[model samples]
Target: MTLTQDQRSLLTAIAQPWIDTSEWPLWANVQHQFDMRGQDADAIFHSLPRVGNEVSFASGYGYAAPMRAPIDPGHMVRLTVAGVSKLPRMRIAVGEPFMHTLRHMIDLYTRRPILVDEVPKTILRSGELTAALPKLDPWFVKVLPDLLSYEPAINTGGGAHLSDGSWEREVTRSVMQFRGMHTVEEYIEKTCEIVTKNAAQTAPFTIEEEQPMPTEPERAPYVDLALLDDLQKAAANTHWKVHKLIALCQGLNDAYKAGNPYVCAAMIRAVMDHIPPVFGHKDFKVVANQHTFMTQRTDKIHALKLVDFKDISDDGMHRQIGSSVPVLTMDNIPQPIRLNAMLQELLTILRKEAAIAP
Candidate 1:
């Protein structure tokens, strides 16, 4: 079967690392194996034109040549197009001993759940069935051996020693073994003690026997209207630039309410840009242009030791902003939520400054 993009990616990730660190003796052994088979080992495995210091995997069918170079170390070996074609045969000849290491390395890199169906055809064809079997979920254990077996199907009729009834009994026994040693009741009883012990240990320190249900406080508005009103009044006596800052604050609130955090992040950066002048920095524009100034300002706000707000701001300014893709997505709700909190804290700081302005 033609490999899927994901399967190819996983295979490349597994192979490249192994080839890089493998000793010269391993390649030599592979060369020797191909030579014995009366094959031009170098032409198949190493005939791929080396562009620079790296060696390609010869056949461009499996992986991209330069982008995903198989061999990292500069070396000349017998790896050519024909040798590459015989890779599956070579792996099979090496058997489970070598494939075990490859399987383990693949498992380490691809931490996602692997299925029997997902095992690449190359792995299956490599005669490492036993090594590859355990990589699948335990449910496939009993059946895989039979499936991979080269033995002819037994004829149940014509006085065959292995009758249908005997085969059925064997299959039943194997299924039971696969399901595990304990029955449902036995397993539950065995595990229940540990569960009960853990629950008791983690029970609340002061549980009230008849406590009234606590009502949740009213949901606060994203923008604090009263605080904004106070700041507006306070800013009237200060510089006119604070009005632009206040407008940005309102935009930030609107972005949060609309669930568009990318816009909210832009607004936050805008607010930061406006902040330096308000704090009496003589060369606020010039200082703000420097990357270090932004980090220093973030650090100053973080040093306020506010309630985990620093963490939110730090994550926003550092991690989230640095990401190539937008941080606000269904899979990454926390990033946007954290940014919202950071924005609120920043607005609070600005509001406080406006309130105390001369």
Candidate 2:
């Protein structure tokens, strides 16, 4: 399959969160439990399938000693399932949503009375699967191996002594570390509001000098030969179309400006590289303002920026891990200094690339 460089970059970026903390056993067990109960495990896996469909289909299994809360024993269990395709696969760790689906399905299935003990309080925890499965196993199956169920090691006051307590401690209610997720509206309105307000309040007090718009014969927007050929086929009157091309270029610029200014500048440079002759003094000015706007309205800029790339440091500072420097602090630096630094860096790269002989 063909993919552009940026498209490939985006695909990898999108998949990284799932790839980082992949746990297969928990996902397999959850799938198996649902599968035994006539639930279509394949359907769930297919719903939000991985970038390559084959990645989700590869399967393997192993046995695991029973584990306590926070440690999923199921993830460690040994098992194997057949894949539909013979292609290689990428394994992903089971995420919270997968666990929730299993928990909810179990709750629905166990509404009727089939046991004496209260539905395992471990299951009640809504997060602990290890303790709850033991409770469910005794009632549902026979000759269940002791290894299938896990009991917590009891702490007997002092530092050295410990008790192997199967039922000594009572299961406390499971406190979900991550509760409900917020809707897009709630997050955008609340988080972005604070970000926007802070940016406006903390913006640098740079003087706005009104410069006259340039009057020298504005360069006619140029279209690539290949694209021009395509346009000629579509339009009945394929004149030089200077005005239309100019308007189209303006439209693209406007679209970029309407979004985060940093993004606008980035897109402007990107388009300029592929579509030649549009790169001029005015284009540079437009791109420059975008940098200034982003730097001045940093809170909004950071908020709009993707989480992973949000915290770019000032050029003078070495890149430090987990540094939370304020975006608009103007100590020893000129107005929008950080923005200017980044803009210069971007422009330098572009100019360097343009100078290279093809």
Candidate 3:
């Protein structure tokens, strides 16, 4: 009953009669529903099958070239039961699960699976349930003098298969006719029952397969992960505004491993220019000369001045000359450990500044 816009869109599209198997209209419907660009939908629709226990796609039919998860809308595509279970998580008009209220209720009230008797109390307190009730059990004109006009799950006879593979044997709403449909209480209980499994499981490959398994080649980190992680955490907290200092430090490390000495030097100089504000200095040279933090770290300070690295960065950036042996190499850059220590100290000062603020 409760569904996200995407979930609603999914349900609405599928609930329509199977007579319209036209591919472009269905795909166009998907595009209009999601409100994304055409270029992105090409990749996004193809990828939905990759989402576990949610959206799925049909496979190619012919014998010549078999494929999995083909998005040809003419072929039937169905929702998995985990997708149905998530209906309770959606709040009527709101697209997000605020607290997953039913799950929270279950977690609080029962150590075991909820009984049909326990459902009424659980349903009344649920904000999503209340909002969804009116839409689901909407007042309708009498079709005849005796029969009541009613529709459950928006009148879709479409079935959602359980990700656990139990739907094949289970007597669920999917198999039930309109006359034998579940009551609201039974519906709630069964919704909880059918969706109790973890959805992360995937099918294992067998020896019968002909193609080699796809393997992604792993590359070692281009930077010290520890330093990168620390900077990334800091950057995450301060992301309301741009953080060029963090970006430069990350680029510096990446350039170091990639063996681009000119880039390393430029990044080093950029960090020196950019990071002085943390130390309350106008420039790195001034920070080196005046700031207590820089003065205290004797080795890093000495390395900055003695190596003439900043000037080399400027000359390479400004001068145009023949590249006989090139202007810079890894030897010209400051020691990685030394640079890391300096960045660590900058983070230390920034944290202290943040802590002391009112």
Candidate 4:
């Protein structure tokens, strides 16, 4: 009997344990043993699970037929085992029913689950998985890794207000430090435009004052120290925290590279807001707040110190402050936060003045 192509493949796989390419001598003996039957046998095969009697086999070298289903599509049976002499010699009986069963089984096995896409959603909220996420902030629903919560060093360039509503940007990086002065100037100008464009949303102002307290009692502040402590503990984990800090820092670097001042500020603000109050260390606060002002262009630039914003009444309106505001310096700012201390202190002064207003 002559075997069909599929049958031949199936038979070869079954006979792999005994007869194979390397066992030419054994194969010759098996062929001779089979030739004794005095008939050319034809066999059939399919990419499906197989059942008994329909497939028959014979081998002098103890080649075992595929007794079980192949676990994966990639696995193919070899015609021989490592030590062929120790294995039982075998012969297979191939027939029509085996091919039919295999075809049917393969057809059924090919279909995948219907809801594979929705499977991930089920696992995403699993208790074990949720435990890995950072503790959620009460104010906002975000769980960023702790390391990303740390601040990176940033430098904000200064600019001067023009007669128009626009501000002329001064290169913020050190003069000797700038690789190309003209290019840096252009970048600063672009940054100023981006900041001014978003100024309405991120309105910078000196807090004037709060309305005087009413006689009616306000709610007692419920200081959630326990919650804060838990979040702080989570923030200390290197994998959880460091990754977010690196990602945010990299994002800022990319935004600056893209010449997107607004994006830089927006990204910094996002980070600042995301950080849980638990990790409110001085360095983190300074970095976040400083970067915020820099990106927003709310703070003063040394190069533009002489520009009179009062006379121009242009974009650099903050420079227009009157004598009522004290000269702001490092000494004037609160020691707790140094990033935007001068600007913040100035705002505090302005607030005091406003509070005293009749």
Candidate 5:
């Protein structure tokens, strides 16, 4: 029966505290005491009758093993996360998720099973010459070998270790749909959170191929395209939010040059909220306060200045237009210490994490 993760955990806790519900065997796992493994052997399996429009045909078997699962990582498979598709071939194994792939491999080895043929003898038809004559070793009335009922292994955990278990490891997970990673900022921000709680949690990530990305501008109107620019030089790279960050910076620059102060202000605030995860934090506030690269208390203060600037951008975004407040102008959005300390932090991180082109 299908159970919610919590329900499965509760049942296991009460019925068998030693069991780890999350590691429960799948239907095709051949390591059970009886057949059907962790589920049940005596369970009734059914098949529907088919005969064109009539129910004259009933093609079914008594018992059989379930179809094998496609869990082999040697097979190349691509998965789309937040619109971009990536071949989930664990590129950087830097965290807890990396350990998970290793454990899965060990489990596969520990529970390795064997495959045996279900041999069947030729069938002797009713009142045939062989049946009418002397009897053979046993009853020979049987269908083809394929029609014989399959038997589960007799010994408990009915699988045996293979002699050679040294295949090249292909790291990948069966799950991890990249849920809640809708936006570029969310991708960066959430990746940090997940990696912190989990680790480079991109075990089966990084790009196999990607559409071409734009070159870094000869010069940006305001701040340089920090993390996103370094990322552009890297080969075979893909980040869900790379384009979005570029677009936001472009928008902010265009708004500033065009004297569109409101759009400039909004984009500034958005960029601040978006880019902090590069230095590894959920928001600019934490990044300003805690970035390890910017160790100088004074340089750290400059990072805080970027965070402080976000307040004005916030005002330009959320504050209502009223006569009591003066309208925004180009002078109002003056660059903060030539993009301040955060850019240094960004460059260091992007260089370390991404393989920049020489």
Candidate 6:
């Protein structure tokens, strides 16, 4: 698929720095660019495979899993000029050929297309790749200007610039530096480290608040149990069901205070489960489970909107995993808090509808 104009712009912006420094652009480089532009790094990073389909050099590009040993760095694999259609067939560690070919391409100053037969058996070794650099340098230099002149019309309004003296000067400087480099291996390694460090330093951009999956929401002040002592005392003369609800509310409030949010969440579900049965609505009795009871009957019978009850129940249940469990996090204080507020509202409705004292 073809890249959109925005995608192309993003790709060019990301690739230019690496090209200018004569380095192979990695996924981290793309991530860094997105971070700088305040775009979603992860979304843009995943989109590369589609964007890469348009670029000849980007075939087979993918992230390499981190090495088993902690000291080794995780990097990306990409098809360079040397690996174009052959790297996938070769037996080597991921990212090896891509890195080696990138070093060779920059050192030799050319992406000389070669047949599979021409590819060396031991291309991973720096010494073997270095031997072929001189032969490729002339071709690399010849095509250098065209490669660096990427998206010339992007900034130059649709028309191409007839003469850009600054572009020529920059290319000349880069060529001179390329010639002055002594060891291809050292240059590649240094550049790789520099790029990795720079990429690491870039923080992922924060998505706008208007977007979904908001971390926090505007909340009402927490209603402490101590402040609700009057309500609890008032329930003494009320029906047994009302007394049971008051006790559940007390337990829910106590769970929150004790920092057992999972317990609080469970208490919320418990209250919902108990309250529906107290009404004895025909629809509530017909439902197979509490999930259906809360979602359907409670809304119909009490005019209480438990539209998000299923989601709340699911989130609460998942949060009840043991401390050792790593499947889901246990930090769900808001779930119970939200449910407590809903329960409070439900209690107020019951007090008025049932005409209970106080």
Deviation from native of the Cα of residue 341 in model 1, angstroms: 11
Off by over 4 Å in 1: 1-223, 282-326, 329-358
lDDT of 3 by residue, 11-103 (tens): 444323211321113444554545553243334434432222332111111100111344553323332222223444322211122123222
RMSD of each: 28.0, 26.7, 24.5, 33.5, 28.9, 27.5
Q: Estimate each model's TM-score.
A: 0.24, 0.16, 0.36, 0.16, 0.35, 0.26
**Candidate 4's error at 181, in angstroms?**
37
lDDT of 6 at 213: 41
TM-score of 1: 0.24
Q: What C-alpha lDDT, on a 0 to 100 scale, does residue 174 get in candidate 6?
A: 26
lDDT of 5 by residue, 1-358 (tens): 1334433322222222112221123323321333433443223211211111111111111112222233222211111111111111211111122223223333433444444775322221223323333332112211111111111110011111111211121112211223333333343234334323322221224478453444322223565422333433331142423445555665676666466788877887777788776766788888777776545777677767767777677777777867798677767774645353455556556656655534
Clashes of 2: 10
Alpha carbon lDDT of each predicted model: 0.36, 0.29, 0.40, 0.29, 0.38, 0.38
List where candidate 6 sits over 4 angstroms from the true fold. 1-234, 277-337, 353-358
Number of the top TM-score candidate: 3
lDDT of 6 at 88: 32
Q: Among all windows of ten consecutive residues in candidate 3, which has the lowest summed lDDT?
A: 140-149
The Cα RMSD of model 1 versus the native structure comes to 28.0
Candidate 1 residue 107 C-alpha distance from true site, Å: 68
Worst 10 residues of 2 by lDDT: 153-162
Q: Give me the overall lDDT of model 4.
A: 0.29
Model 1 per-residue lDDT tens digits across residues 201-248 = 433356655554553322222444333433444444554434565567
Model 1 is weakest, by summed lDDT over 10 consecutive residues, at 152-161
Tens-digit lDDT string for candidate 2 (9-104)? 323332332233321234455455555767644343333222211211111011112122343422332111111111122112222222333343
lDDT of 6 at 196: 44
Q: For model 6, where is the 10-residue window of minimal lDDT?
A: 152-161
Q: Show pairs that collide, candidate 5.
A: 90-203
Q: TM-score for model 2? A: 0.16
Clashing pairs in 6: 108-137, 109-140, 110-140
